[model samples]
Target: MGASERVVPEGARRRRRPTKGGTVLSEQLIVETTLRLIGEHGAAALTVRRLGAALGCDPSAVYRYFKDTDELLLAVADELIGRTLNSWRPTGDWRADLRALGLRMHADYMAHPQAAMLACARVTGRRHEIRSVDAILGVLRGAGFPDAEAVRIYHVFVDQTLSFAALDASTLALPVRARELEARAWRETYARMPAETHPHIAATSGVLVAEMDRSGYPAALEMVLAAAAGRLAHVRSGPPGA
Candidate 1:
């Protein structure tokens, strides 16, 4: 090794084992590095060969932990679930709790936009994923929704949040310059549309521009929560199966 070049300390560099190069390789390390690569270089950078190069090991070594890329991707998705659920600090109000948790999930996915693009639709069937489903259903049922209604509402709540998050993250995962340009589209394009050509847009353009900087997910989430709350009230007062 050259003076500036660091040596690859002996740690099964040529073998498929726990540690590699100078680092102790684990599921967490691989997942974290995969996310970092996706964040820094987009999802395309997550190939086994690329990861091996980054970790200073052979590409085939990746199989020691994950059987293949799909499993690794699921693990990455599960990690996102862990982070989102872990951060949630629920308020007593069902509406408020759902809103906060939904926003948290959205923000968490957006934070890793490249990964979100691939993993948002994945059902990990892991601990984090199972617990999250249970918790959401529990919250709704606890708030007076019967089992079937609670399950239906939970599906809507999660699907809406993840679907919108994936859409937003695609834009966010773009190159920084591209993201800036897209971010300004509402103001730079729609807000400037001539009033004579589009009266309704002109009338509300000011408010549109003001709120364009805001994400639509939060508002959409509130609508879902409010609708569920209303249904719960009805269900509570109505006779059984009425």
Candidate 2:
């Protein structure tokens, strides 16, 4: 019989069909499962073998979807970006909208503290991510920024927000052993500082320690937005000589 005319065995044909809930695995499923695993066990506990086990498949199944761990991390990062964009609504006021988006992004990363570290520097080139960049650039352009200036500000805004979020999450998610060591280091460093040699530091030491719990993310984001707006205004008002 011709290959096209050959009939499959009854049991083999049945096996080829998807079960009610066992549809063909997809990238979304993988990414969602990865995030859930990271949330439950932390990023360090995530491995291809473990992830597959959690997904009821073999490690090779993941490779069919993602090239490697880095690719998977990038997909996770893209998923995070999509989540942030979904939560942010852009009001007509560019600065306020941008600030709101930054705050939301920070909070989202803080919620998924473990994933932040892995995703901080990844650029996934996903569609929604590109649209986000375009939206921010459009906002800046509408606010009278030159294309070049808008692009620069976009980079600054994204990098600063993500970097800050990652740093905050990493510090907060430090393992118990690491946290104790960090505390000891802080005590030793402070003890070694002579009051006269560092009078300003000594005076503010208590305030600094006490204010560590204060939310600096919003303040820092505001500062960046203000600086960018100021620069844009200056560029608009000044001539080539100025």
Candidate 3:
């Protein structure tokens, strides 16, 4: 097919002009396909050839939607954000809403850890990324935070959520054997530390052992939300001009 007949049109990636008699692909179609590929085969599975095979188009047609794998990767990442945010409806309680949102993001990342590891902390400057920032800021502002405080709290909440997601995703993205070894160490080593030598470790051994098979995102997320809650409480209690 000719350049003008390709899915993205001749001038820009934003255009969704599908080719004549070719498999009609759009940016959304390509992104959805990319996400599925990553979910099934990990981040290493994405390539123009593979995507073309999956989409029933020429490999060159894949480039009609994206300049390269890196660019397409950003789109995939942004799609995850869009999917998550789109599914979330805000509750009036800010703390509960924030907690739920954080957990959702953590779960979403865990579901596609390789993709999360690649894009969790990335600043995509895409529509979904912008929407995510707006959503969080709206939550804080709606909860009665002043503009500056809302902005600061939004940064803390988002950074904490994405950072923890990235860390967990990195571990999940590791090869199976390596992850098994790490789990073994967590269960065997930390759970078996001697009381005399490490009283705190021994005391917490049960929790540690149980957590060996768990993602620590929930507890860490709770801590972050609790901190924000305290800040909000303190601001509410401040004297009139102080």
Candidate 4:
């Protein structure tokens, strides 16, 4: 095989790509570009060839920074987590703080709907994710919930936040016409359902038409916070070991 065609060893740094318009490649640049491409063309646009093309480099160069596409994607997911938590300051009121954090997370994810759809369910296990987990645990523990209950509530809080983000993002990610169709379904189809078969839906159709198109994350977040507050009250009311 020609020396020029030799495969680069894993973890070995490759020479920088010859500059095109003096643009240099870096992990941050690659991630940002990937996000832009995903935003422009959806998640399917995230392949190595497309990324390299966008960055003006060989596809192999991406492997130097990320072990594989999955690793790169995890980094992208971590970036979203980082953006959500960046410069976040807790207000010392657990409920208020959590509500703010949850809202911030949902907003950030919705801003990058295509990326959120791809990443919301991933563990990431990267630095940003680790920090978020620690920060949330601290919030729970700081609220005076016992360790066990805190952990349980943290699981529910994070999962519910991400799940709702992904769910809402899917709607946002749809093509404009498709989204319009979905909105029309809530207003037209459900609102016009037969009183004989879907009596409840019929009776509540007016409310559903008004509400169904809206994202449910805020209400769901409130319910979670309320449940956690109740749990904390119960724990405080119990004996120490109870």
lDDT, candidate 1, 1-242, per-residue tens: 11233323434323445444677666678789888888888776568888888777776666766777777888899999999999998776788889889988998998888999998899999889999998898888788788889899999999999899899988787788997887688888889888899988889988988887767998898889888988988987899984
Ranking by lDDT, best first? 4, 1, 3, 2
Model 4 ranges with Cα > 4 A deviation: 1-18, 194-197
Compared with the true structure, the alpha-carbon lDDT of candidate 2 equals 0.79
Candidate 4 accuracy as lDDT: 0.86
Global lDDT for candidate 3?
0.81
Give me the runs in candidate 1 sitting further than 4 Å from their true place: 1-21
Taken over the whole model, the C-alpha lDDT of each candidate is: 0.82, 0.79, 0.81, 0.86
Give the best candidate by TM-score: 4
lDDT of 3 by residue, 118-158 (tens): 88878899999999999989999899887888898888778
- Candidate 2 residue 30 C-alpha distance from true site, Å: 0.9
TM-score, every prediction: 0.87, 0.80, 0.85, 0.90
**Native RMSD of candidate 3 (Å):** 3.9
Error of 1 at 173 (Å): 1.4
Q: Candidate 2: where is the Cα deviation over 4 Å?
A: 1-24, 180-194, 239-242
Clashes of each: 0, 0, 0, 0
Report the Cα RMSD per candidate: 6.8, 6.8, 3.9, 3.5
Among all windows of 10 consecutive residues in model 4, the one with the lowest summed lDDT is 1-10
Give per-residue CA lDDT, model 2, range 142-184, as digits (tens).
8888778889999999999988998988887888899778766
Clashes of 3: 0
Screening candidate 4 with a backbone cut-off below 3 angstroms (N, C-alpha, C), the clashing residue pairs are none
